[model samples]
Target: MAAKKSEYTCIKDNTIQNISRKTAELEARADYKDKRIDEINHNMEIMNNKLDQVLNSFNDLKLQSTSDDKELELRLKAIETKLAAQEKTTEDNKARSDRIIAIVSVILAALTFYFNYMH
Candidate 1:
């Protein structure tokens, strides 16, 4: 009976050692997984910051493009206005020339008629 009891005690000790070993392995795996999660979170933060910078750059470029486009549109409108004014001035000068020519022609016709009647 004493020999049987010693045998049982040995078996129990081995089982406890096995359990402890398994527990240690599980703990190590859990720690490694936690460290990996932390690294992933850090990398994610860096990526988010980079993405934010890119978005800000895009926004600035968009604003500058919009401002440049507006300025170009204004310049085009001013050019169009100047062209219209030049066209109107040209038309007015032509009308004045036409009136002067008509008056000169009438005066010449009247002079010719008077001279012919006198002769």
Candidate 2:
């Protein structure tokens, strides 16, 4: 009976040692998981900051493009107005030249007919 009790005590001690080792392993694994979660959170924050910067740059480009387009449109309108005025002036000059040529030709013909009749 004394030998049997000693054997049982040895078995219980081995079981307790195994349990303590398993608990230590579990604690280490939990610590590693916590560290990994912290790293992931930090990386996410950095990515969010980069995303915000990209968004701001995109908005600035959009505004600049809109402003340039408006400026181009105004310049085109001004050119069109100038061209219309120039064309109207050209047409007016052409009509005046035609009238002057017609009047000069009629006067020359009349002068020729009078000189021939008088002679």
Task: Pick the lDDT winner.
Answer: 1
* Count of residue pairs whose backbone atoms collide, per candidate: 0, 0
Candidate 1 stretches with Cα past 4 Å from truth are 1-8, 100-119
- Give per-model TM-scores: 0.69, 0.74
Cα shift from native, residue 104, model 2 (Å):
3.2
lDDT of candidate 2 over 1-119, digit per residue (tens)? 46555343465887899999999999999999999999999999999999999999999999999999999999999999999999999999899899888898888888888798865
lDDT of 1: 0.95
lDDT of model 1 at residue 26?
A: 100
> Which pairs clash (backbone N, Cα, C closer than 3 Å) in model 1?
none
lDDT (0-100) at residue 65 of candidate 2?
Answer: 98
Candidate 1 structure quality by residue, lDDT tens digits, 13-70: 8889999999999999999999999999999999999999999999999999999999
The lowest-lDDT stretch of 10 consecutive residues in candidate 1 is 1-10
Best by TM-score: 2
